[model samples]
Target: MTETTIPKRGVPLWVQIIIWVFIAALLVLVGITLNKRQQGTVQPGDKIPDFTLPLFSGYEYEGKSEVKLSDFQGKVVVLNFWASWCKPCEQEAAELEEAWQFYKPGGQVIFLGADYVDTEPEARAYLKKFGITFANGPDMGTKISQMFRIRGVPETYFIDQTGELYYVKVGPFVSVNEIKSIVDQKLK
Candidate 1:
């Protein structure tokens, strides 16, 4: 019997390269879609998302250990995102603490700090150094940061008494008075 040779059936190099490029593009598109979803779009006049997290530093409110955004409903909420390693956060720490003292006593406002991407020991040290007494907790897996679409540290969000987002401050606040002015407006 005579042996017959079979022809090779291989994909062309150019077609192979094109297929890989298409796959890479598809993967990148998918990544962008997921990223957009993760970075939620929260705007003023919109109801702020509620979250509950364990406080790692600062005071526990009303004999409860965990801090919940919903707990402060019908009250103005100052939600601040910060990290121990961020200098701007350090600069505004005093201002935040002062605001906390002023409003906390009135029972019409609540200041909560979301310590973003930081270790507990370092965060506690930062709070201690800054003399921060407001409720502060780690953002645990950065869930809160993603919800707020935080771009950097020292970002502050003010929620009105009705639980609607009123304003967003993206950097270190000038003074406690400045924050109080906004809080006063929201209170009204």
Candidate 2:
């Protein structure tokens, strides 16, 4: 009888490479997520992050598409992040518009609507429905949202004239007075 040797089977080289590549990609993704989480959201007393917003059609300032946070210096800035599909946003839509109208003449307060992740037609329609006349615009690439670390739609930030965040409202303001109170305090 002759002695026989058996061959051992192992994972293919290409298969092992693919597995390693997959694991590496997954690790990279997790690292990015952790980094973002560590950055955290903007908070009261923090200096407002400077950002430029591209206003929607018919909402531009001085016929300019780009509006910078610094442009509204020496004025209180009400930066509201909202979406057309958000119910809580809808609830405060009219109130926000009213507040804008009230403060429009003074020019001491500037209201900027940052429509979050919304389509133009629908966002325009939502604005028309609510009669929003503020400097409403799309948060392009969600850069503003990321900079502010917004949790959801209808989050409003009150920035004082000095470019410091004074307050953060996580949800809809129940009344125009509620919105005004914050603005009044910041304007002081």
Candidate 3:
């Protein structure tokens, strides 16, 4: 009778390596998904994400090249997302400027315009047309919109003094009072 060697009882080396690789990939995918979910969208009462926005030509704040959300720690922020081609944005353009002017003297509130999906020349012209004097900047690759998960143009986010989101307006404001109503409430 010949003595036969016993066969290995465990998984083959190649099979085990493949399984570990697949498991690692799965873990990485799950991690990425969770991270995206955490930063996906902001809502009322949630802290808004901080971002540095490069001001467009002639829109700098305090002569600075860019502005960061964290820079205004104790001030209410009126952040508006608009596009040069948006008709609804045009409707509220002057109203927003009026509201900005109304709050500018107080120094407790700041208005920030984030131009979305527009050429610099057109954005500048739109600002000039509306006579916008507050700090305005380009979104630059739509990063700001992505942070807020904006559905469309003309969306505005009212951030309270504590840096939490106070309100969200999906459409353009109809009047200066309409814009002021929200900012005024946030000021409180």
Candidate 4:
């Protein structure tokens, strides 16, 4: 004669404990990954989706106010995403500033910066430290980062007046010449 043992109704105590432990571990890992992704890690050829996140004031000399992607339409825009803590971003800030200076005269291309995942005070401080005179904004809640799916700091999007992304630079620009070359290629 053969007999079958039935499984426990509320799950085996040992098995339940193991499952709970695993679930807890998994939740913890997921939470960490999500926090990391909030800062984003972008890639090339990613389409620039339209987003209207808040741009904090005081970074620019005049018209120092909030700006959205839609705000600067009808002009070639260099939308650079960066943070205060990124070394490469700090390195490229001046080059981007120079590009802004060069392009501002012709009104050919407008350059704007976004202080991703940072405080207004920190962002403004970075601007002062890096000598980035272009207008900037704070991604207070990281709305813009999520919207564009930014992979990391120092991602520059060459967007035409229609808000279409033409080129994406993942790292810093070395010189105004380099910035100009890319801008010239796309602004037209």
Per-model CA lDDT versus the true structure: 0.86, 0.92, 0.89, 0.77
Alpha carbon deviation, residue 17, candidate 2 (Å): 24
lDDT of 3 by residue, 106-164 (tens): 99998999999899999999999989988998999999998898889899999988889
Scored by lDDT, model 2 comes in at 0.92
Instruction: Compare the candidates by TM-score and give the number of the best one.
Output: 3
How do all models score by TM-score?
0.79, 0.81, 0.83, 0.71
lDDT of 1 by residue, 1-188 (tens): 99999989999999999999999999999999898877554778888778887787345666567877888888999989999999988889999999898887789998988889998889889999999988878888899888888788889999988789989999999998899888999775
* Local error of candidate 3 at residue 171 (angstroms): 1.4
All models, RMSD in angstroms: 5.7, 4.8, 3.3, 5.7
Worst ten in a row by lDDT for model 4: 39-48
Q: How far is candidate 2 from the true structure (C-alpha RMSD, Å)?
A: 4.8
Error of 2 at 21 (Å): 20
What's the true lDDT of residue 168 in model 3? 91
Please give the TM-score that candidate 2 achieves against the real structure. 0.81
Candidate 1 ranges with C-alpha deviation above 4 Å: 1-41
Better of 1 and 3 by lDDT: 3
Order the numbered candidates by TM-score, best leading.
3, 2, 1, 4
Better of 2 and 3 by TM-score: 3
Look at candidate 2 and tell me the lDDT of residue 95. 95
**What lDDT tens digits, residue by residue, belong to model 4 across residues 147-180?**
7777788988788777777777888888889888
